[model samples]
Target: MRAAAATTFTVPAELSAAEPPEVRGVPRDGVRLLVARGHGPLRHTTFRNLPSALRRGDLVVVNTSDTEPAAVDGHRPDAPAADAPPVTLHVSGPAPDELFVVELRTPDGRRVLDGRAGESIRLPGGVVATLMAGHPDPRVSTGSRLWRARIAVAGGLRAWLAEVGRPIRYSYLRGDWPLDAYRTVFATPGPEFASAEMPSAARPFTPEVLAGLRRRGVGVAELVLHTGVSSLEAGEVPLPERYRVPTATADLVNATRAAGGRVVAVGTTVTRALETVADPGGLVRPGAGWTHLVLGPDRPARVVDGLVTGWHEPTASHLLLLEAVAGTALVGRAYAAAVDRGYLWHEFGDSCLLLPIRTVHRAE
Candidate 1:
């Protein structure tokens, strides 16, 4: 299905957060939180009070996929001049037969790197990636910028990435940040690094916050969803990404719902993963596979009752998912409040919680 271009809004330049709160001399949980019910005036709070905002017996599902240093500098060996502009490879995810889905970005992250199919680009740390074809998904727009490429690294992809790749950064960020800063407190260390970008919604969570949630009887569970490169241009649907919803998470979610408890998704990644596996009866099944599921207002959610996420760009497809959860009117009110209150924007910015007024009353 084709989605119309999202409407735009003006975010003040000063509202763009250049660094994480820690780098800005604030504790992780000290970040601000904007709470919005399904229909009401938005309220402001601190991230540390997340537990108080959640109901007892509620299940908070999170994406434990760790961010990978997907951005690597590369050059075209076949270029005519030595002064050829350098290219950047933003690794999206693994493809079949040792190939990868990647987006070619300019060095400054402004535009796509133009190249023909069958051309080989030399990447740093002795890696070579050959552009094999355009994105395999037929539903993707003809103007979609992703490509399927075969990667050849001397010691393999992970080792090469460790030596040369950096976390994918957009034009808004000031400079490179350490891998530690990109990781969430609950990120799991696995053999394969999955996400092209950090699931930034959980970045404000800390051990203290987790303890508070536990003490408040709010159950937390994790699922894995290897997210693709975001920051898409206008009107672009996200490509398919891999996900694994374990039996434990599925059972917990179903149990919570059966007990008349809320199932809160910590990020859009979690919402996508859960909704992909949820049936109309609101039962989630154990599954492991790739999903191209896109959430919007037309698609009513089955399992997710609330969402905890960071502030998104005005035109982001994620805003559509937020609309699905909280409705368009509430989302508009919450966003207006957030912008007027000078809440920061981007990955390191403040967060918003979207729930129904009835659910908030139950939690309280």
Candidate 2:
């Protein structure tokens, strides 16, 4: 099958969801859900109906990675003595030698910061981040715009971040939101903060939704994939991120498959973690490590039979993964239907389910 990695689409700015449905006076689970089956008619439903949409034997795997406050406001120590533009630092992930893979954005979140190597930037709460080098990935094409820097904080990194950092937000958002808004309902409370951004597919789920799934005999499993900064720019490839699939979850997935159940991933993060440790026979194994896996038309899914995710941006690289799960033709139809129905797009928006169908034809 031909991969659609290079394919592009247009998303109108008006269709972007500037605020969460809850902020608009709707419940968390009141968002829309677009159900797209391979070669089947597209179905429009609500997120609360998820429990009734799947079979009893289906296993839903979710990412339990907690969101970290990765964004912080900073200023260059050596700028013009008059007026220096403030910078926004987005901590992508950890790098070798206590360094961090960071993206330098302007205060408006429109362009990257113009800084040179060896420059010192003063951040909030007395933290100083120094640019150690340019693009860390040698495999990246020449003139890449990413930055690699090291930070010096008085206390521990996590503790200091908790005090000064805010959740990384894009320009589309209406205003600043608290860190709690970026976390999923199933997020585990612990010292370890994993994702640089939210694993948003499960954001629409609430306690009521989980209870419904449990009562319907649908199994839910958990995995952790600390995601890095999202590559929202057009044609940008995502960087590697840490992931872990525990033995319990792997066993559940394998057992469910053996019992003629579908393995449904709640988000792209879960799908990436499971596929990384999946054997040729499609059996998942317990594993933990960093993965640079990128799913597209060229990469066919072997472990995940279905995917529950949110509507992605037109230029988002994640669209390639959706195309891999559902064919190109089907994905096209699904997006058309979503836009036609005025479904919201983004982390706090609606959801979509791509499942298998008996027929292999495009929806009309």
Candidate 3:
């Protein structure tokens, strides 16, 4: 399949890429959340008000896959002993078998680190990653200086990251906040194996919001999509990361359909997981596996009828997944509304909740 290409909406470098809303302080569940119908315009609301937006019997599928400090400072194994450029190994995904996909870069040139597959690089706190085979060029733009590759991590992965790695904060954040802020309240205790940034949807639905959903008859299910480091370097094409949808979540997805309820993916990560497991009938089946599926206009969505997600920049590949659900026209409308009305962008910004066309009626 043709890789989903980048859009014009990616925030330009000149635009201030700060994360927090201007003049606002942090609140765990208080970020803005917008709701849009498949064929309608965007509506604004805070995340705490999510239960009011959905009906009973709607199922919310969340990605429980936590974030990892995939970005590490390292030196090139092949570089000359003294003058080797200080390199950053931005981890991406595991290829078929145990091999990994990693991005390697230096002041001189950028390339994938493959020749030393299985060689261990000790991190700041004794954590090590066994270098693995490299995969395709996941670059979205030409002339990018950063490269994509993968690696096999060793030791208590989560613990190791906490000790040595900085939270792989996106460039827009200006400075890094505590990694804890990036993660969801429900994140599994272990170190994240894949995603570079925390999938933000799980952020808003705290225990209280979740209980409210449950009381209102909403069913919650968890899926895993270990995300890799985002290829957000200037002029770089977005890269694909490793992802997995566990069997139990798949079953809940199917069950939600059988019960005639909406299957609502909580974030792009969950959307990617469910889309990976879809069959010819557009139904999701039970499975625990990896995926490199890139959803966009060309890729028809099968499992999710609606989605709740953050307001990503135009360049973010996540928008392609949203296009799959809302269609290009609807996405354009929602985005226009988001920008015109001053909706915050990025993980710490506002969110958008999209409903399927059939459910959102427009009176003439």
Candidate 4:
């Protein structure tokens, strides 16, 4: 089957939901999933079967970036003298050194603002958010415009979040979902103030499933990437969220490659982590830093050889990263199969495991 080109896939608004899935804590590896080869047809499966899908010595890279309850609502300090209407501040992104950038949505429009460095944005009921920095992301209008910003947080951000911030629920499932629904089963450490929801590599991996994969010879590695809240706004412009790949994670990837193992990224985040640090010939080195690198068809991958991820919306920028690995033909084929099979879309939907075109051919 031929895959569709990057230009051929577009995000459709109808597919996104205003609510999240009704299911919660359904064993990370118990989620429904699909597997496809190149642009070929899809095969239905459970997430627990993921390890069986790969060969021994294939390195599976997972993003351990935890989801953050970064959404906050408040009134603008620069509010007009007239009646001060409340504004919604989504602490969508973070800057270097734990500073925060926030999206301020008000009657005027959505604007990106920075909280006073080390100062907090006081919300209704004593909830205070420390301002980090103010670097505005590109904007899109939806009756009111939407702006993405980063923010720094402290003083029980996670505990207080249970009381104030709502799980940055996608427009799906029609109602609010519990926080556990937005996280992976193996989630450790408190949530970061960056990701709106989990990066989800751990989505399909239960403790048992991970053990099985290890038994089968698949080596797994983890990395932390504090992703910003997902801006699923229709027609939203794509922007890079600042992230860091720790030296330890880099070492594992390098060791795997040195041993001639296939490095399989668990999600786009892992792909970003590997690609961000990789040089030519797919050589990986230890490093920590921010990456604005965007991948697509024209750009070849230096580190990642495969990606395991959920179906993306038509407007999602993730389509570009998919193209970089499997090419337009393979991704298009897999996506079409996903649609025809009635596989769910978005974070709660089924997933696909994509291998490089070369690997598929070699297997053939």
Q: Which model, 2 or 3, shows the larger lDDT? A: 2
Number of the predicted model whose lDDT against the real structure is largest: 1
Instruction: Compose the digit string of candidate 3's lDDT tens values, residues 216-307.
Output: 88888887777665555433434555556667777777777777788888888788778888885656776666566767656768768898
State the weakest 10-residue window (summed lDDT) of model 3. 140-149
- The residue pairs in collision within model 2 are 3-297
How well is each residue in 218-329 modelled by candidate 2, as lDDT tens digits?
A: 9999998988888556766666778889999999988888777888899888888898898766778999988877787556676788899988877778888877666677
The lDDT of each candidate is 0.83, 0.81, 0.65, 0.64
What range of 10 consecutive residues in model 4 has the weakest lDDT sum? 137-146
**Each candidate: how many clashes?**
0, 1, 17, 22
- By summed lDDT, which 10 consecutive residues of candidate 2 come out lowest? 355-364
State every prediction's TM-score relative to the real structure.
Answer: 0.93, 0.92, 0.78, 0.77
Give the runs in model 1 whose Cα sits over 4 Å from its true position: 5-8, 78-81, 137-144, 357-364
- Candidate 3 regions exceeding 4 Å error are 1-23, 39-41, 75-84, 96-99, 105-134, 137-159, 190-194, 232-244, 359-364
- By descending lDDT, how would the candidates be arranged? 1, 2, 3, 4
lDDT by residue (324-351, candidate 4, tens digit) is 8777777787887776666666776667
